[model samples]
Each structure stands twice: as structure tokens, then as C-alpha cells.
Target: MFKYIKNDLPASIVVFFVALPLCLGIALASGAPLFSGLIAGIVGGIMVGALSGSQIGVSGPAAGLAAIVLAAIATLGYENFLVAVVLGGAIQLLFGILRLGIIGYYFPSSVIKGMLTGIGIIIILKQIPHFFGYDPDPEGDFAFFQVDGKNTFSEILETVNNISPGATLIALIGLGILLLWSNVLSKKGKFFQLVQGPLVAVVIGILFYVFTKNNETLAISADHLVNVPVPEDASSFLAQFSFPNFAAITNPAVWLTAFTIALVASLETLLCVEATDKLDPEKRVTPTNRELLAQGTGNIVSGLIGGIPITQVIVRSSANIQSGGKTKASAIIHGFFLLISVMLIPRLLNMIPLSVLAAILFIVGYKLAKPKLFKTMYQLGWKQFLPFITTVLVIVFKDLLWGIGIGLAVGIAVILIKSYQNSHFLHIEGEDVDDGKIKMTLAEEVTFFNKGAILKELDKLPENSYLELDVTKTRYLDNDIIEILEDFSTKAKNKNINIKLISERGIVENPPSYIEFFKLRPKTSV
Candidate 1:
């Protein structure tokens, strides 16, 4: 673990920049104080990173939880919502204890890709208003509409009319810094590489805002400022801590929210674990069950301390990898950085412009949806590609979870269709049959699904003198199918035909065991 620190420390800086806006954005989306999200990020980084079995998974406040948080707060009070969060954490811990970590494996690859792509599009879309310097009721960027009730596209139209010239100019400058930071200076030298592009862009954005203020020619204004809440003193800062409402523990809504957050957050975490492992330079696989336990434990602690729900965030994890993180140390250190940075440099943080962070996020967004990424997924197979592209597009146009759900449904449908096709009625082999008495064979594991086809073939076996019913190699035979054979056998007897029974169990004596007959027979090659 310590070894991971040395290698990942550099990468943590990049992750820190990426995690910043996300923390704020998710908090804003959750209808909580902006600092609450930051608190979650800090604690998630420290606690989850330390306890997690995963080497590459990076924990932080998640966008996926934002909707839950928003609805919870609206339905329950903010204090009640905090109770839900804490309760959610406790529930997740219980899940870990039950060893339900493998649940993450059930999510198909297509669905997971759809989820990530969908999230990427959301990040880009949500950031658009901020990039234009229009707050329009600061819910960050998680909705189809502005908090003012204007839809996303309508908000954009409103942004054109209400765009603060100063914010736009600052944003453009931030964009320039981001472009230069990610593309140009990044390749210059060892010295330049150590200094992240987002950091420079942020600094330039802040200073530019400060310089252009009230200058008609430069066009900077008050609305273009970072709205970081300023605490008057230590007492006010410390007063932000929220306690869990034990009374709400029994409420079904609270329990429901807890399970919802745990399930969604855990799924997101596992996907991040896999994706992060893929991005690993050493290419090590993180212990997934162990990761679930870690996240569960982290959420419990975060909830207890008044932070938002947490997950293994991919944006930060990927940034950590791209920034050259080689171990968990980078992830752990970033958490410590968050803890120390907020407490010690609150005012200094206020100096950073949102536009600069936007620039940084723009970079992160580009990395996720890069055209090369599209081409690469496309090459994998249509099974992977169609859902992935569709997911990204829907997620861009609609909601994140909805896009993922759609992708997952489509992926499952594709698999089931293939399974049905592969499971044909009869896989016939041997000489081509021009005669009425044709031979047919069931697959090794035949289910009742194949009964219709088998019945049709049996009906066509004209009152024959010689008909061979071979089940010597068949592993599974459903009772419905057995009944079909029995009916045919009785009919053959009426026709004075001899039906050969070549099976492990005699056609007349096979019992109605659900699935045991299939496994009892040792595979025989004919």
C-alpha cells in the first residue's frame, strides 16, 4: 500500500483537480451545502482509500447518488435525508458483512459500458451552463432542466441572453489554459508535466477574473465569481457538522433510500474497480468483494460525519491512472490532500475560479469520450459497440441511470436471443436425410424450450418399422418433453412400429427430477 503511494502521488494531483468540481457539483445537486460534497470527497478519499482492498479504485462523492439525495431531501427534511445517508452507509456495511460483493459481477459488460458512456455525456452536458457562466439556481449539472424550471436546452438559450461577459471571457481563458495544459505544455518536459494543466488553467482563470473586474473592455463581472461559502471563523466552520437522526432509522423511506444508494453506488464502484484495473500500468485486478466492503465501510463513516454518499468514481480514478498513479498511495494521498486543503486553505480555495475547474472537467470529459474510444469499442463486437454508443448518446440526451438501464436491457435481450438461437430444436448430424424417417438429436442440455421442434420431427417419422430415439448422450430431459415422447411411443405401438430407446434412463422409467437427470449422465461422444 505504501509502495502505491510513491508511484501514485503524482497522479493524485490530477485526480484532485478532477474530483473538485465533481464534489461541489454533486453536493449542489443533492441540495446540500457545497462543503458537504467536499467533505464527502475528503473522507471518501481518506477512509475508503485506506480500507479498500482495491489498489486502483478511487472513492468520492458520486453523481449517481445526486438524484436520490435530491428526492430524499424533498420528501424527507434535510436532517431526515442525512439520516438516510447514514443509514444507507450502515446498510451497505451489512451488505459487505453478508458477502454480497459478487453482486457486482451480474451487471453485463454492455450495460457497464453504457453506464460509463452515459455518465460521460452527462458530465459534458451539465458543465455547459457553468462553462457559459450561468448559475440559474445552482443544482450543479445533473438535471434535464435548470433549477429555475427551464429545461437544459432552454437554459442554454437563456444563457445566451444572460451570459455574463466576464464569465464568458474567463471561461474562454480557462478553456485556453485547459487546451494548452492538456495538449501542449504536458509534453514539454519533466518540470512541465509535474505541473498539471488544470491547475494552471484554474490559476489563470482566477487571476483573469480578478484583473478584468469592472473593466468594460475586459468584461468581467460579479456573477462570474466562485460562490464558495465563506466562514467567519473556526466556530462557524466547525458548526457545519450534521448528526444522523436515529428516529428515521425505522422509516421505510430511509431504508429504501439506503438500499437504493448502496445498490447504485456499489454497482458504480465495481464498474470503476474493473475500469481502473484496466487502466492500471501493472494491470493488476482489484479484489472486488473486498472493494464492496471498503466502500460500505467508507459510506458508513461518511454518513456518520455528515458527508454525501460515496463511490469509486471513474473520472477521478482514470485521471489518477492517466496522471501516472502506480499504487493505492496516490488515491490515499489525494484524500489526505482534500482533508488538509479544505481545512487549511479555505480562503485560498475561494480564489480558484469555477471556469478553471470547468476547463479541467472538459479535459476529463474529452478523455472519456475521445473518438478513439468509439473506434476501439466498435472493434470489440457489435454486441459491445451498439449498446455503448447508444448509451453515450441517450445519456447525453437524457438521464444517466435511464441510459444505463436501457443499455443493460438491450444487452440482456441480445444475449437471450442468442441463447435461444444457439439452443435450436435439434442439432442434427450424420448423413443428409432425404427419407421421411429422419434422425434428430437434442443438445447436451435440453430444456422444455426444444419440445415443440422435437414433437414436429417425431410426428413426421411416418409409421415406420425402424425409428431410433437416441438419448444416450442427452444430459437433460424435461418432463414435458418426456410426456411428448411417451405420447409418440403409445402412437407408434398402435401403428405396430418398434421405437428404439437408446438412453441412460429407459423412455418409460425416467423420473420427473427437475435438473438432476442432466448432470447424472456422463457426456458420451457418438
Candidate 2:
């Protein structure tokens, strides 16, 4: 891990810049103490990164969980919510130990893509308000309808009325710097590469804030600036850490909240792990079970020290990967940066404008929801496209879980519809002949879904027909399908349809019982 420091160090600086506002933003969105986000970021970086099997995946306070955390905190109180976070971590650990990691693989690729795209749209919409310095809703709130009673689009209109020229200017500059760095300067030399676009944007934002302090028309208000908790003294800094209330351990509400957090956080983490692995240039696979354990432990530690719940966040993970991170060291280093910055330079960080961060996030969002992705999914056909679009739309209109649920439902429906359509094929051989020869070829895997088709075709067969039941190419025959064939054999006698079972075991003529005949297990060529 240390060997990659040359690459990891620069990447870590980029991730640190990316994670800083997000940590505070998510905490602010959750209605938790501002410092709680920093704590989670630190633990996610140092502890989780150290333990995780992923080389590129980064864990931190997740925006996806902010809504849940917000409600949970309100319902259980801050201290009690910490208890829930701890228990949630424990539950995640249990999930890992039980080897339930494979569950992540069950999500359809379309649904997963939809998730990333939906989150991308959310990021763009949520940050738009901040880009113009609207501060009624917190920085990281991404719901379609906000806590302030305004929807996503309405807030944009409101932002126009409430725009701070200072913030808008800074945001424009930040975006320009980012675009230039990515598109031009970074390609010129090592010096330009070493100077990350986000860091430069943040520095310029800080300088702009300082220079315009006395200007009434261009001064950014406190509401539009990064709000790290500034400690005046050592004692006050230490007082920021809030411990979980052990007495709440006996509360059933605490346990319920814990399970909810564990379930949601683990799911979000697993999904992010999948996305990050795919994004990796080397295509390295992260151990999902181990990731769960790492996250669980991170949450436990984070809660013990007054932090929000942590998960493998896609925003930070994507930023890390895109910034050329080659190892987990970048993640760890970013955590240390969070720790040192908050402890040593909170005042300096507080001077950075939120608009700059919003500008950076905008770029990230665009990359995730690139227009090309839509065309690619559409070209894949509706079987993939429907679920992908549904997930994206639902996520934009509703919440993350709801979007995923509806998307998964649509995906499953597509699968079932295909299964019904392709269950079997009935070819009436030698039509218009005195003796009809019907050939029924079973699909590769004949399940209960094919029973209706097979039954209907059997009923349509003319009297004294010669029917050939072909299973030679089938690798699996469901018991229900076998029963259907068995029952059909008994009914075939009435139609005077002579049945021949053609399979890998050769043919059986007028089989007394389909099950009995199959039990013979005669070996034949494919």
C-alpha cells in the first residue's frame, strides 16, 4: 500500500477536497452536529480503509443515509441515535460473518446503472440551489421534495431570487478552473497535475471571500460558506465528541433503528462496492463480505465518537477512482487530512465557499449521468432500458430505496414475461396429412412457467396424432413440468395420440407413466 504513495498521495489530496464539504453537508442534512460528519469521514477513511479488501473503494458519511439518519435522530434523540448506529454496525458485522455478500450480485445491471444515474441527477438538482447560495435546505439534502416544503425544481426558481453575486461568481470561477484543469492544464505538465482542480477552486474561493469581505454587493454571507465547527480552545474542541447513551441499549426503538440503519447502510455500501469495482481500470474485485465487516466496524467506532453512520459512498469512491487513486492509502490519507484540518485549521476551512464545492459536485454528477449512458442503455433494448429508466425516474421523483424497489420490480417483470414467451415451441410437423405429427421441443430449462403452453398445445392436438416430446437439449426439467407431462400422458390416450419421449436417454414409446419412464435413466448421445 505504501508503495503506491506517489500516485496515492496526489489522489488523496483530491479526495480530501471532495470529501470535506460532503462530510459536513451530509451531517448538516441529517440535522446532526457538524462535527459528526467529520468524525464519520475520519473513521471511514482510517479504520474502514485499513480493513477493507478494496483497493480503490472509499467509505465515508453517505448522503443516501442522510434522510434516514435525520428521521432516526429526531425520533430517538442524538445520543440514542448513536446507540442505534453502533448496533447497526454490529448487525453489519453479522451480515459479513454470515457471508451474505453475494446478495449484492442479485441486483440487475440495469437497476444498478439506474441507481448511479438517479443519484447523479439528485446530486445535480440538490447542488443547484447551493450553487446560487440558497440556504433554506441543508447542503446535501437530495430528496425530490425538501424538508423546507419546496420541491427540487421550485428551489431552482427560488435560487434565482436569492442569488448571492459573490457565491455565483465564485462558483463560476470554480467551474471554469475545474473544466480547464480537466480539459487542458493537467495535460501540460507534472506541476499542473500536482495542483488538483478542486483544491485550486477552493483556494480561489477562500481568497475571493477574503478580498470581498467589506464589499456589500459581493460578500458571501455566512449561510453560503463552509461551516466547520470552530473550536476556540482545546477544551471546547474535546467537548465536541458526544458519546452514545448506553442506557438506550435497552430501548426497542433503538434496536429497530439499528436494524434499519444496518440494512440500508450495508446495502448502499455493497452497491457502491460494485460500482467502484466496475470503475476500476484494473477491474479489481472488492470482497463484499469483508467490506461489510469494515463498514460495520467503522460505524461502531464513528458512533462511539459522536459521528454519523458510514458507508462506501459512490461520490467519494468515484472521485477517488477518477482522480487516479491506485490503492487504499489515498482513502486513509484523506481521513487523516480530515482529522488534521478540523483539529488544526477549521477556521481556514470555514472560509472556503460552499459554491466552490457545489461546482465540483456538478462535474461529478455530470460524469455519472452522461447523456451517452442513456443512448447505450436504450440501444440494449427495453428489457434493460425499462428498468434503467424506471430506476432513474423513480429515484428522481421519490427516494433511493423506492427507486430501487420499483426498478427491481420492473426488471423482474421483464424476466417473467420473457420466460412465459420462450417456455417452449410447438411445431406441427407434416401438417394437412391424415396422421398429424406434432413435435414439442422443450426449452433449455423447462420450469412451471412452460406448463400452460405445453398443456394448451397438448389439448389442441388432433385425434390419433403422433406427438414427439423432445427434452434432448434440456439441462433441467422442473418437477411441475414433469408432472404436467405425466398427467398429459394419461390424457393422450383419449385423443389416441401416441406419445414418444425423446431425451438424452433415447426414446420411450407410449410411456405408461412419464415419471416412471424418466426414472429409467437410459444413457444416450446429445
Candidate 3:
């Protein structure tokens, strides 16, 4: 890992810049203290990254959990919510021990794509107000219906009446720098490659804020700037850490919230693990169980220190990978940066404009939900496109998990429809064959849904006809299907239909019942 320090160290800086605002933004969205987000970021980087076996996946406070966190904090008091976070971590540890990590693999790809696109659109929409210097709502709030009772579109309209000229200018400038740095400067030399665009935008934002302080028209307000909590002294800094109320452990509501956090955090972590593996240059597979263990530990520590919930977030992890991160060391390093910066130069961070951070997120959002992605999904046909678009629209109007659930439902319906249609095919070998000499070929996998079609086909066979039932290509023949074929065989005999059953095990010539002849079992393994 040390050998790759040259690559990892610089990559860590980029991730640090990307994660800093996100940590604060998500906290704001969650209705938690801004410091809590920083604490989660620190723990995710230092604690989780240290324990995790992943080469490049970075963990932190997640946007996906913002709605849950917000609702939980409101339902349970803030102190009680901390207890839930700690218990949630313990539950995650149990999940890893039970080897339930494989459950993450069950989510369909269409739903996942829809999730990614939905989040991207949310990010873009949420940041528009910040980008324009309208800071009535806090950064990192990604919900369609906000805590202030305004929807995403309504907020954007409100921003028009109260746009900050200073913020708008700096945001435009920061976006220009980001675009140039990524598209032009980065390709020019190693210097540009090593220097991330977000950092440049932030530095310029700070300078612009400092120089324009006396000019009211060009001056961004304190509300439109990064607001890191600054402690007056070392003791005051130490006092910022919050501990959970142990008394809340007995509260049933607390337990319910904890379970919700555990379930959501674990899912988000697993999905991020899959996405990170895809982004890894070496394609190293991170142990999902180990990842859960690591994340559990991080969340426990974060909760103890009054931090928001942590998960392996795709945005920061993808940024690290894109910035050429070599190992988990980059993640660890970024954590330390969060710790040290908040402790030492939080005042400087406070000077950075919110608009600049908004610009950076705009690029991240654009990357996640590109126009090409929509076109590509559409070209793949409705089976994929329907779920993808549905996820996007639902997430845009509702929340993350709801969008995912709706997409998954659509995706499953498509699969069932396709299965029913493609269950089997009937073929007559000879040209002059309407004499019920039919060959019925089963699909590779016949489920209960296919039973009706199979039954329909068998019943249509005329009397005294030669029927051949083929299962040679099938790997799994469901019990329902097996029962149908077995019952049909008995009925066929009464009709004087000569039934020939063919399978990989050999052929049977209407000698016995279908169940007894095939040695049917409750479940068939492929």
C-alpha cells in the first residue's frame, strides 16, 4: 500500500474535497448538526477504511439515508436517534456474521441503474438553489418535498426571486474552472492531473469572498458559505463530540429506527460495493461480509461521537477511483484530512462559498445521470427502459427507496410476462402433421407461471395422437410443471395418445406415471 502512496495520496486530497461538503450537506439534510456529518466522514475514512478489505471503496455519510435519518430524528429525539445509530451498527455486525451479504446481489440491474440515475437527478436539483446563492434551505437536502414544505421545483422558482449575484457569478466561474480543468487542463500535464478542480474552485471561492466583503452587490452572505463549526479552544473542540443516551435503549421506537438504519445502511453499502468493484481498475472483489463488519464498526464509533450514519457512498468512492486512488489508504488519508482540517483550519473552510461546492456537485450529478444513459436505456427496449425511467421519475417526485421498490416491481412484472410467453414451443416434425404428432419443448427453466401454458398445450393434443414431451434443454423443471406433465401423461394414455418423454436422463415410453418415471422432487437444482 505504501508503494502506491504517490498515487493514493493525491487521490485522497480529491476525495477529501469531494467528501467535505457532502458530509456537511447530508447532515443539513438530515436535520442533524453540521459537525455530525464531519464526524461520520472522519470515522468512515479512518475506522471503516482501516478495517475494510476493499482496495478503493470509500465509506461516508450517504445521501440515500438522508430521508430516513431526517424522519428518524424527528420521530425520536436527536439523543434517542444516536442510540438507534449505535444499535444499527451492532445489527450490521450480526448480518456480516450470518453471511447475509449475498442478499445484496439479488437486486436487479435495472433497479440499480434507475437508482443511480435518480440520485444524480436529485443531486442536480437540490444544488440549484445553493448554486444561485439562495441559502434558505441547507446543502445536501435531496428530497422532492423538503422539510420546509416546498417541493424541488417550487424551491427553484423561489430561488429566482432571491438569487445572490455574488453566488451566481462565483458558481459560474467555478463551473468554468471545473470544466476546463477536467476537459482541457488535466490532459495537458501532470500538474493539472494532480490538482483537482474542486480544490481550485474552493480556493478561488474563498479569495473572491474575501475580496468582495465590502461590496454588497458582489458579496456572498455568510449563509451562502461553507459553515464548519469552529471551536474556541482545544477543550471546546473536545466538547463537540456527542454520546448516545443509553436510557433510550429501552424505547421501542428507538429499536424500530435502529432496524431501519441497519437495513438501509447495509443495502446502500452492498450496492456501493458492487459499483466500486466495477470502477476498480484491477477489478478486485471486496469481501462483502468484511465490508459489513468494517462499516458496522465505523457507524458504531460515529454514533458514539455524535455523527450521522455511514455507508459506502458511490459518489465519493467513484471520485476516488476516477482520481486514480490505488488503495484504501486514500480513504484513510481523507478521513485524517477531515479530522485535521476541522480541528485546525475550519475557519478557512468556513470562508469557502457554497456556490463553488454546488458547482462541483453539479459535475458529479451530470456524470451519474448523463443524457446518453437515458438514450441507451431506451434503446435496450421497454423491458429495461420502463424500470429505468420509472425509477428516475419516482425518485424525482418521491424518495430513494420508494423509487427503487417501484422499479423492482416493474422489472419483476416484465420478467413474469416474458416467462409466461416463452414457456414452451410446439413443433410438428412432418409437413403433413395435424394428426397430433407434436413435439413440446420446455424452456431452460419452467416455473409455476409456465404451468398454465404447458397445460393448455397438452390438453389441445387430439386423441390417438403421438406426442413427444422434451426436457433435454431444461435445467430446472418446477414442481408445478412436473405435476402438470405427470397428470397429462395419465390423461393422454386414456385418449390413446402415445406419449414419449425425453430428458437428459434418457427417454420413457408411456410406461408409468410422470412423477414416478421422472423421480420428481420438491425442488430441482440447476
Candidate 4:
């Protein structure tokens, strides 16, 4: 795990920067104490990272759960909500034990690709306002309709009027430095590679803020900077940690909330696991069950210590991957950084400008949704492209799960349509003769979905024809299809169509009872 310390250390710093604002912002959005988000970040990074099978995934308080958390807190109270979180974690552990991680494997590849690309576009769109210093919404809010009552586009239009010259200038400089460090400087020297461009951009941003404090036009306001709560002393810091009200576990609402969190968090974690694996340069597959167990443990620990719900976050994970993280050490170390910085150098951290961070995210977003990928998906044809584009558009317009849900629905519809069209192949051996010979070969897997196609083809068989039904390649023939064939055989006799059935068992001249014949044979191919 420590073999890539050199790579992991730099990547951890970048992830820490990315995770910090998100942690605080998500907690604020959820209507929970700000410290709880940091607690989630710390626990997710260290505990989950240590236990997770994923080499690159970073877990933390997710923005996706903010709305849910907010309502739960209002209904059950904060202490009571912690009880739900603990139960949710226990439920996740149960899911892992049952090996339900296979659920993630069911999502189509097109939808997964669409998810990554859609999130990338969202990051770029959402960060533009922050880049210009008009941050009405929190950092991690990725929904189309924001918590601030403004949608994504309206917020950008609003930012145009409220632009801060100081923020814009620093953002430009930060973006430039990042581009230079990544494109030119990093390749020139090992030292540049070790130091990381985002860290340099952040440091410069801080110095600029400090140097321009007295300047009216150039100085960045505190609102445009990172805000970490400062503790007056150790006692005050310890007081921030709240314990769960276990007595509330008996509340029916608590149980429902727990189940909701467990389902949503597990789904989000699994999706992130799939996306993160795709983003990994090494392409290592993470064990989904292990990931669930790790996440469950993290959430339970976080709840006990007053933290928001935890899930594997794609943004931070992508940041880690883009920053050259090679192992889970990067994630674990980032957690330590969060713990140390919040306890020690929070004042210094608060000096870093949000615009500079936004600049870093701009690059991360670009890498995930490159223009070439759009064309590539298109070239793959409509079967793959429809779901891919649908996922992207819906995600940009709605939310992550909504996008996936709609995309999956569309993908399934496409599959059914294709299946209905290609259920069987018909060949006219001698159509011009008075006694025509026709051959109809069934697909490898014939289900009820193919019934329409088969019925239509059977109805078109000419009178006084010889029909050869081939099932040599078929496996798992649906009972509904067999009933259709039985009815067709009766019709064929009236039309004077002689029917010959061919199968793996043996050829038969119109098998007396289609259902009875299939019952004696294996449903699948031998």
C-alpha cells in the first residue's frame, strides 16, 4: 500500500483540497452541524479507505443525500437521525453479507459511461459561478435545481452580474498555473511532478489573498474563501462531536429513514465503484462486497461520532485518480490531512480561495467528458448511443439516480425492440413452386418477447408449402412461444403446409404436442 507513497502523497493533498469544501458544504446543505461533514470526510477517508477493496475510490459525505438528510433531521431531530445512520450502516453490512453487490454489475456500460460524462459536464457548469465568486449554492450541490432556488443556468446568468474582479483574476492565474504545471512543468522535472499543480495554485491563491487584503479592487472577500470552523480550545473542539440517541431506534420513522439511507448509499457506492474502476489507469476491478462492508463500517463509525452519511464519492475519487493516485494510501492519508488541518491549520486552510479550487475542478471535469468521447459513443451506433446520450442529458437536467433510471429504461426498451425484430430468420428455398419450401431458424434464446415476430412470420407461410422449423441453435425456449408454435401447427394443417421440426433431440414431422415434446427435453442447449 505504501509502495507508491511518493505518488500517493501528492494525490492525497489534491484530494484533501477537493474533499474539504465538499464535506463542509454538504453538511451545511443537509442542515447538520458543519463539523459533522468533516467528521464524515475523516472517517470515510481513513476507515473506509483502509477497509475498501478499491484502490482509487474516496468515500465521504455525499451531496446526493443532503436533501434526504435534511428532511430526516427535521422529522426525527439530529440525535435521532444519527440512530438512523447507524441502522443504515447495519443494513449495508447485511447487504454485503448477502452478496448483493452483484446489483452494480447489472447496469449497462453505456449508462455508466454516460454517468461519468454527465457528471463532468455538471462539474464544469456548476463551478463556473464559484469561479466568478458568485457562490449562492454549496460546492457539492450537483442537482439541476439547486437548494438556492436557482437552477444551473439561472445561477450562471446571475453570476454575470455579480462577478468579483478579485476572484476572477485569481481564478485565471490559478487555471493558468494548473495548465502549465500539468502540461509543461511536470514533464520537465520530477520535483514538479511531486509537488502537484493544484497545491501550487492553492498556495499562490492564498498568498494573493493575503497580499491584497487592503486593496479594494483586488482583495478576495472571506465569502469567496474556504470556511472551516475554528475552535477556541481542545474542550470546545471535543464539544463539537455529538453522540447518537440510541433510544430513538424504536421510532418507526427512524427505521424507514435507515432503510432509505442504506438503499441509496449502497446504490451510490456501487455506481461510484463501477465509475472509479473505469477511470483507473490500471483498470483494476474492485470487489463490490468488500466495498459495501467497508462503507458500512465507515457509516456506523461516523454516526457514532456525529457525522453525516457516507458513500463512495465520484468527484473526490476522480480527483484522486487524475492526480496520479496508485493505491488506497492516498485516500487514507487525505483523511489524516482533514483531521490535522481541521484541528490545527484551519485558519490557514480558510485562506485558500474557492475560485482557485474551482479552477482545479475545471480541469478534472474536462478530462472526464472529453469531446472525443461523444463522437466515439455516437460512432458505436444508436443501440449504445441512445442510452449514453439519454443518461447524459437527464443527469444534467435532473439528478444522478433519475438519469440512470431513465437511461436504463430506455436501454431495456431498445433491447426488447431489437429482440422482437431478430427473433428468427426466414429463408425461401423455392418460393415460385406450387409446393414452396421455407426454413425458419430460431435465435439462440427464444423468449416471450420473440412471440410477435415468430407469429407474424408463421402467418405469412404460403398455402401448400413445406415449412422447416429449425431449433438446433436455440436454448431456453419460452413456454409462451411453444404454445404459439402448437397453434401454428394446427393452422398449417388446414393450409396444407407440411411442417418439419428440427432440434438437437431429433427431427420430427410436426411434433404431435409442442409443449409435451419440449417438456421431455432440456430447456437449454446441451
TM-score of 1: 0.75
After superposing candidate 1, which stretches have Cα over 4 Å from the reference? 2-7, 137-140, 145-147, 217-219, 379-381, 424-526
The prediction achieving the highest TM-score against the true structure is 4
Residue-level lDDT of model 1, residues 1-526, one tens digit each, is 6765544766787687677667877898788878888878988888888888777668898776787888887887776777777767777777778777665544554555556656655666666767777766553465564456677677767777766666667778878866776678878886666766666676777677667665886654444455555677789878887767878878898888888888888777876775565456554546676777788888877777788889998878877776777777878888887777767776666666665666666766666666777786776567667777776766666666777777767766665665665453445443334553434555554543454456556555566455655665654454435545655656566655665555665552323332344335453521
lDDT of each: 0.68, 0.84, 0.83, 0.88
Question: Candidate 3 regions off by >4 Å?
Answer: 422-526
Candidate 3: tens digits of C-alpha lDDT, residues 1-526: 7788877887898788889988998998898988899999999999999999898999999988998898899998888899999999999999999987776655555667778788888888988999999977766676788777898999999999999999999999999998999899989998887777778888999999999988979998998887889999999998888889999899999999999999999988987886676557665657789999999998899898899999998888878887789999999999999999999999998998889988988888888888998997786568778888998899899988789788878877876775775555332232226665777776677654454456556677788889887777776554445655666666776788997888776787885766565455233422
Q: For residue 330, give model 3's deviation from the true position in Å.
A: 2.0
* Ranking of models by TM-score: 4, 2, 3, 1
Candidates 2 and 4, the one with greater lDDT: 4
Clashes of 4: 0
* Each candidate structure's count of clashing pairs: 4, 0, 0, 0
lDDT of 1 at 446: 50
Candidate 3 structure, TM-score to reference: 0.79
- Model with the higher TM-score, candidate 1 or 4: 4
lDDT of 2 by residue, 267-363 (tens): 9898888778667776565778999999999999999999999999988888888888899999999999999999999999889888898999899
What TM-scores do the predictions have? 0.75, 0.80, 0.79, 0.81
> Where is the poorest 10-residue window by lDDT in model 1?
508-517
| Candidate 4, superposed: residue stretches over 4 Å from native | 422-526
